[model samples]
Target chain A: MTHQRWFTPWLLVAPAAVWLAVFSLWPSLNTVVLAFTNAKPLGGGRFTGVENFARITDDAQLGDALLNSVIYMVVCVPLLTLLPLLLAVLVQRKLPGISFFRTAFYTPVIASAVVVALIWGWVLEERGLVNGLAQQLGVLSGPLPFLTDRWLLLLSAISLTVWKGLGYYMIIYLSALGNVSRELHEAAFVDGAGPVRRFFNVTVPGVRNTMALVSVLISVSALRVFSELYVLSDGTGGPGGQDMSVVMLIQMYSRGFTGHLGYASALSLLLFAVTIGPMLLLLRLNRKAA
Target chain B: MRKGWLIPVAAAAAVLLLSGCGLGGDGGAGEDVDASGEVKGKVTFQTWALQPKFTDYVQGVIDAFEAAYPGTEVEWLDQPGDGYSDKVLSQAAGGSLPDVVNLPPDFVLPLVQQGMLLDIEGADDKLNADYVTGGIDAYRYTGHNGVYAYPWYLNTDVNYWNTELLAKYGLDPAKLPTTVDELIAQARTMKKESGGEVYLMSRKPELGDLANAGVPIMAEDGKSFVFNTPEAAAVLDKYRAAFAEGLMPRDVLTDKYAGNAELFNSGTVAWTTGGGNYITSLATDNPTLAPKVIPSPAMGTPPLYAQGLSVASGSKNLPTAMALARWVTNAENQAAFAHLVNIFPSTKASANDPFFAQSDGTPSGDAKVIAFTSLAQARMLQPVEVTGAMSDIVKQQISLAISGDASSQEALDAAVEQCDKLIGQ
Candidate 1:
């Protein structure tokens, strides 16, 4: 009876295990194998050891893409993680018409990236809202090159990423906030701790695991962001492709025009490794905190 | 949740994912049929922008083809102009290529390299009877030894300038520069006289700058880069200076295919390069600015191309596909197709016809005459002899130079080195 009971648990997990193996694990393994080959767009390719890696090193735009990706992650991760926590705490209170504000904040999460880009593209154009405001205030004479300048374009992309991610992470934090014990806050109140201090000591510590989850999620999204950048800048990546993300460069290589499937696969593996490195660091930090 | 309770959710998740199977593959290669034997089976014909507007005309052509070739069925498909090149190549690789499909000029070399196109030499004599030579040359990406597509329609280069903007600064539109230096001088004068309020250009005249300056972009072999000299550097420097001077739009380096159209129509740019049809679009956007527009001769080798039709080499119904391709591009059909879309036809007979050559007194007519005149010198920018992979590297390097991030000499040297590596590879 005991042996049968143990066997049933394995049988129960077998389906999910097979599902992951076929859909996720196999494709990732295939991609890693392809990084070492002269793969065409389709299936077959010839093995060419380390040639793709050499090409990656020699690629002129690789450095720019990596730097852009790093800048993106740095600007976005903290913004998504903290801003949403603040917003979630604010909206979690029992207030009249609070759901409306919650819905409004969450609207962008459901909107497509292309749609968000189009709306923001208009708002940031020369004659658009920001410039109009500047012109009205007489603080600036000419329109700001919001979408034109390279640094400004990167700023715009990072801002867009933060805005799009705010509501998503807010929902995550809201669920975690529900699990935060009210007794801790009551006990802190009895101890004479102020709202800010109690929040730092109680709410933040209570949601430490959720913070780590949000960090990983936002980091991956920031690293893989392409569509918004592409739609906002029309895919040129701002002048000498200074604002181009690593994934966007990989996309260009994978497109039928460039036909660098092997190189793109190598880029994919590199991106995977890059994504995992930060994730591992986040996990380590999470463990230390625990 | 309990272990037994979680089983339902996991099973459901696994089932949902496993059910999402990918079912995609081609029907198979077509069987051989006698040239004169009764033509049968279906051929899927496609185009980029020839539907809804030309529904009747296209249907008539299909009906005629079907009637002429008994038992043969023509299935027409229309794809959007955006991203058609990528979609076509991916489809070719997926083995689900349309029997006869439109070929974008940029996709021609890539598709040929992938061996997805049919060698249309089987009926070359009939197909080439009175076709435009440049159009035919554009489709022959594999060189004179092979023909991959049937030339269909052209979009000749014509630069439309804002005469109102020019005349406001006491500049004469009739005295437009024919050479690169003169153009740069004109740009400087426009920027200076206008006090930097109005820009002179929005796009970098790549082909024009090189073609007019008499600098060869690539050697005759197309494999070697011969543009690393001072002449190339001068052209790059001139454009870089223009950009630095704020003569061009800020998006000059990154404007996509719909380059600077919105900026020009908004009365910002003084010059915009496009085909004759843009006159209508510009006029539609700004009614008052329509009469102020001046159509000028193309300055460089207008690297416009005739979108053509190609039968996939892996097509099962080659005979039917070839017949449909020929029928679609025959002189009479091409002229009719041109009338529907306001595009330049690629057949000698159609282009030579008075409908395209003769000018009416309207602004649109003047634009057409300039476009037709420029067609005589239009060159396909995709150099046939050069590999597509190498060309991309060259173009990206040129963009870097234009952005002023890389010096002109550095860009050229880098292009040369990369091209050599690509050749060696």
Candidate 2:
């Protein structure tokens, strides 16, 4: 057996360990401490002891934000999970110009969210392409308030999130599909299973673990949605701030004279608590599978 | 002995964690300085996003200041426009604020409250007489006892109308609205004539509009808001009624509402309020639309906007910092700056400058002439205490009222209550 100095392991991990301590552990601990205070962004703070968390109960804006999160998650998880898997299956085959199609679908995933949101903002404006085309088709008498109405704005952000996320999840599904048993697929085909039957019985069960992981990722991302909603609404949080996400509330209180860093920290803790539910659920499901 | 390294690692971790929390430090406090000493030290001067465009002008001013002071040096730092408030706040908290800093009226309020800025009036008694009353009064907060900054530059809003759009919609471009009631009547006429294809108004009523209509936005002491009066509600009611009648675009209350300048550029709106340099800037964006633009005085008490240079209270070189601030804001330097841009000079003596009084027969030149004259009657319409967050609450409440979700009075009351709560906090 080789003998090494006692500090060798420590020296190797010191860089990563220090980074984690400074950026992650320290900030998380400080956030916990700050959540009990009334800290302004300019740095004067005193312990108010649950006052911020107490305000969360009566905050009508928080209530609206929670509802928006639920709607976003409920819609995103299923669409993102199944649509990406189907897209992976379609593109997994060897075909002519397949790389081009794959790249075309994956382009939005690589595009900057701000640029994408700005383009969508122009596309959904009252005089934009969508409304103009619809009106020109004699399908409507007037333009629809796609970017103005609260529900429409929320739905628009959700659509953008899903559109942008599709290629990312598709690549994950493609990697998982490669690991599935090709023999099982061929055996099911020989047994006279149709494409739909084979996909459900063979392909799905094979990638069930990857699907759970994707669902968890989608759930956390939907709960933590910021840029899609922020850029879409130009950072106003939609009409009367009714379509705000919890993360948006945190960002709202993180700067400027009106910013309360302590309250933002409390909101951050609440977000961590909310997101942990999906993660715990995934862990439970994995344990059952084990 | 096997885990000897753990002790040092744990110690370092604890130190990092404790330092990150910033235990026992009151970041808001700063030591007051006496400015009665000789001015011969290096002073750091910071401006907001004025580089590359005004580089030569600012460098020239700095060079002149150095020449006048002989041994003094001015280190210039120009910050970008985005996230400037947050940047300044962080710098103040970290005790790294520049010696001489340029800040607007609203941005000065927080620093003054924290005692981070020097009292300019206390430092120099005769300095107040150099600047215009409106310019000096902007730096005087309601609760603050002394002025905190030397007023630098002044600008006010000018109404820009698209003559071609108005003429196309059968509204006379020569006869522009001079008051809110007249503006609303023209909006109605334009709405009917254009079949709602175009809009005269493209924005919701802000605090300035309510103040222009004679609503006191705050109480005398400035501790709380009192703009929920019937007069304010009446102004909102007019907007609500006009909105219901499709006189203004539906999206104007929402985030989808780009400002009036954008809507004007697109030819969807006939009016936008901008600074004296509006026509010059507009020509760069859309040259075709610039020639057809008409400049007129704002519909109400033209809202005054001022930028000023403040001295950091904790600055070691207080004398040089204060001297540099005063020298930069002097009438000669201000007039030189005004000559480069259409912005007005804050110094009272600059009012006599012929450059501001005469028009070069261009649209922008006419705008400068009108803005210069309007500055005489202009005041800071929106109080500095109304923060961005408070403005957002007002925006949301007013949006609720305009969309028929609540009455105008209820909206104003809610806005006042929320804004007052923020102030109390």
Candidate 3:
């Protein structure tokens, strides 16, 4: 009898449910469907199953993109996850004006990515401040080509990504750090454990769940690193296509020369598979860990 | 419990009712009840004019268009100084394209091939004959059924020199390089004479500034890449030598479009190939050390070139768009735009517009007359099918070659192979 009345609660939620179904869920499903076909934004294409996947496999540019994506994930994910934790712990200390330090670190998040890239581009230019400073300090006889050279290009882009993301993830860890029982650190010290060991055993495990959550978040972000590369290299990626990633390839596929909507859809589907499948697997692992 | 359920159920019903009412209200509000099938609508117009130097004139013209056409609104959209093309293409793919847009003249063929444009009324017909003969041709693509854009304006590349820099280097103030070889020699001379303080010449090695030159770097025949020829390599070799001689920075290969401009304005670069408006900008921004504009040194023969504008084919109101296009190219409007912009006008009649006559405070003299005659000879890049992919492939490979990562032969071979693949597709 009580269950009969609960039907009204379900009915009341129906409109929001319908809204999400139409806008979010349906579009995502359509993207997957279109990815399997040669359909364009204007529509009209026949289905082609694993052909897109096979084509992505054979494409040299796509291969390069996949490699770059993996590289970004491998380098950026752990650094992004760990650096923020370290930064949060350092800032959370009762050092004077810790609040001001937190605000200063978070400020980059408020600035737009394009602006950040532009500022960094200037700082990294051949005669830019970094090179000028290095030369003045007798560090090098010549300036380093930050945007042009492959090694430096990737280094500069990754550094910018880590810098921009630090404060945001710092705040996340900061919140988690707040809930850590202070008594645990005291007990560890009473047992005569050093500060470093106490931090590793007590502080780290105290926020293990938050660290896991942020790791997954950073992994997903690493999968979609486009704007920083695009901004640094003026849309073409770095010279010789050294820093080009999958998202840039997807963009080029969609609207570049031929605007092969079908090809782009195929690439999109492949990208979705690459990004989401692993993310879900990781989430499942996280659940198991929990 | 039953009463509580009623509250949620009533809320859901209210939401459904409110949405239905909203939809109905929207449909009623914008209904065109007038007998005339007039679409009083707005269309976005995107352009790359951003600097305080150029944006005002562009915005002024757009404003004039909207003012002239009472019902049709023209929204001006400006791209930022960097990553302008990337943003433009992204906006196009997202299908939030401005109804009207301007791409660099050389990019017209690629844009058409991508199906980003809509067919217009005046592409191939006798209507195109009314503008400069070759102007409409550049905006046409074979893959596109009809003309996709209308010819907007023409500008010619000229050599700009700081007479102060030239005089200080012990070079003649009035004389300029007359041939490719002569330009190289002068570049070397300027470098040595200036104690390596100034770059005698500054331009991107990819020859982007030269893409508009009247002669094709590679001919229309797809079989061979002409830019990889001995003559073009000779040009690149000169740049390589200049770079080696410390006339230009070794990292010149990495400099973006504005790097040379900055070098020129800052007085570190003595002479360079620059846009037509450089002299005007110099006079306006840096009056004391205003650079003198002169004809480009001959490369076999003096060739002329300029950027072109076109109307998009996918426009919803074709006639209105055509009207706007025609109006912009008309003698009166071209003259207005010319006065406002100080670039050469598309129309012959508008070339003599008082704007150019009074500009530089120079009277209708031989130099002005010669500049106009050169405009007549000015040619844009020919419209080629498969240009979009072909050019990108060329750019990619050439960038590699310029960076010393690949040989010229390897780059051209890769480009040709890529071009073949694209053409086959």
Candidate 4:
């Protein structure tokens, strides 16, 4: 009788399982398979196993993109992780208009990416507010080539991502901070520990689970930072086309040469490996913390 | 009278036969359909546009098509512009695409290379007999042999000027600028006349997407970007000169499309580029705003250029799609489309129409002269080559130069390096 009940339950879940297997698992499997084949979007072609990956590895543009991606992630994640924690701490003080500050930080995350990008484009354009103010303040005589120069373009894109991520991540940190035992902070204060020490030693340790989750989120976010780069650099990435992300590279391969679908699939697998391999390691560490 | 009746019957029979051949060619090599005889099924068009815009145009075309072929119903799966080509490719990969799709000209060749597009060369020939030569070529992406795309509508960029502003600045409405030098001189003259109360010309008018559009004024060869070339430098120098000389305000770069158009309507900007294929409607749409068209003066050596449109190869309904495309380019329909769109027709016949030649005599100026001059020496967007990095190079370099972040040379050099990388030069 129990076995019959278990069969019905399995049967009930079969449709959804099948749906995931077909839509998700199948496509992923296809991506991995096609990575080794010279199959195009429309017509089948010869197998070119490891050739696409070898080409990507050898390509100078991909190298630049990879370097840029690393630099972007390295620069952005720390700021994204720490800034929100600080903001959450500041806002958690129950000071005057703290709710307003919290709302302000959260507001940017709710705005559409396109709107955010457009507004940022204006603020960062050659003669935009930053330059104008800098000029007025005698900080610089001319505007920075924020989107034109490869280095500045990467920096600008990362900073914009940070700005957009800051508020949302801050809210998350705040919720986690709220869940921290009030007794811990009160005890830390009783021990004559300074605010900074308490934050680093006690507060951080308490929110370890949230930190692990948010770190993974930020890491993945860094890996897929497409919109900011696309919008800022007008989809060319940047000058010398050095800032094109792996995702952008995949898009170009898929689109520009529709006949090169196999190569694109290969690139897709490469991206998946680059993104998930590290992500899985982080997940393991996160599991260890539990 | 009997001879005329025979000609009519013959013409009708010919169209039917041609349409049939077109349908057969599109439905794989051996697949054939008797769409002429009581065809009843729903065919969907996959294209780039949101629901409202897509629905309106698709519905309009479908209604016309269904009225002509009663048993056919057309549905739409509107793809957003973002990741549009990718969406189409994914469909192609899965061997599933809508019956028709409006493909960007650049995507046609690659799709054709994938053997995705139906070879509608024969049907295209019929369309070419009626459509403008250049317009047809816009759809001919293969350079030779394969004709993958059909020219749906022809668009050409032109100069939209404030006639009232020109006259106010003691400039003759008939005498538009013919060269880069003349354009600069006109801006200077207009600024002095206006006493710096308004800009002589706006760099980028803050209009919707115009701010980020980054339309580059490049060289003729399309091999080299001129935005940083001496000629481009000269153009930029003239712009910077205009700003420095107080002929144009530094703030002009902040102007959007609406602001720029408004500037012209309010007699501020002396001249600017008109909305391609929709200049006339821009005027007609705003009856109170008096604006006129002028030919875009040669910034470089020879003829001026405009962007073009082409059908996508991924379309499943190539026969009906080609037929509908032909309908948009036919002399009568071209005239109607041009009249409705309020822009110059690509075809010489419609362009040379008495209606286009003789202006409606609106208070702004002679619309016909404006239309004709603008169409006389038009160029087209450069073909996708070197990984299709031309547009990117042009946009980046031009933005740098315009913003004065980099000298014309530095920007051009950087752009050249990028292009070289893409082309493997």
Chain B TM-score per candidate, please.
Answer: 0.84, 0.93, 0.70, 0.66
Task: Supply fnat for every model shown.
Answer: 0.30, 0.44, 0.15, 0.12
* Worst-scoring 10-residue span by lDDT in model 1 chain A: A37-46
* lDDT by candidate, in order shown: 0.75, 0.88, 0.63, 0.60
Task: Report, for all candidates in order, the number of backbone clashes.
Answer: 2, 0, 7, 15
lDDT by residue (tens digit), candidate 2, B1-425: 88786799889767664445444444553344579899997999999999899999999999999999999999999999998887888888788999999999998887887789998888888777888889989999876778889999999999999999899988898899998888889999999999988999988888888999999999999998999999999999999999899998888868476677888987789999999999998998999999999999998799898999999998999999999999999999999999999999898888789999999998899999999999999999988988776787788888888877789899888888777766754
Model 2: residue A101 alpha-carbon error in angstroms: 2.8
* Residue-by-residue lDDT tens digits, candidate 1, B1-425: 34585789768645543222111221222223233334688889888866676789989999999998889999999887677767776786577999898886566665665566766654556657678788887776533346678888888778788888888875788887766667777888888898877776777645335545667766775566676778888888888887887777666676643466676788887777778788877777898888788788777666665788888777788778888888898888988876655578778777558888777877678888888778888876645444455554566666788878899889878877766654432
Residue-wise C-alpha lDDT for candidate 2, range A34-90, written one tens digit per residue: 787766665456667888888778677788899999999999999999999999999
Question: Which residue ranges in model 3 land beyond 4 Å of their true spot?
Answer: A1-23, A33-55, A179-181, A255-260, B1-129, B143-152, B193-197, B207-247, B250-252, B255-259, B291-328, B332-341, B345-371, B382-393, B419-425
Residue pairs in candidate 2 whose N, alpha carbon or C atoms collide under 3 angstroms: none
lDDT of 4 by residue, B93-159 (tens): 5667665666755666555554556555543456556555665565564333545454444444456
The candidates, ranked best first by lDDT, are: 2, 1, 3, 4
CA lDDT of B367 in candidate 4? 40
Q: Rank the candidate models, highest TM-score first.
A: 2, 1, 3, 4
Best by TM-score: 2
Per-model chain A TM: 0.87, 0.95, 0.89, 0.91
The per-model DockQ list reads: 0.29, 0.53, 0.18, 0.23
Candidate 2: how large is its RMSD? 2.6
TM-score of each: 0.86, 0.94, 0.75, 0.68
lDDT of 3 by residue, B104-158 (tens): 6545554554555655432334445456655555555543445555566666555
| Per-residue alpha-carbon lDDT of candidate 1 for residues A1-290, written as tens digits (9 for 90 to 100) | 44566567778998998899778976776677667766645333556688888888887777888888888889888888899999999999989999999999999999998999888888887668988999999998999888877788889988888898889889999999999999999999999999999889999999998898888877877888898788777777776666778888777666665366667789998898888976787777778869
TM-score of chain A of 4: 0.91
When 1 and 2 are scored with TM-score, the better candidate is: 2
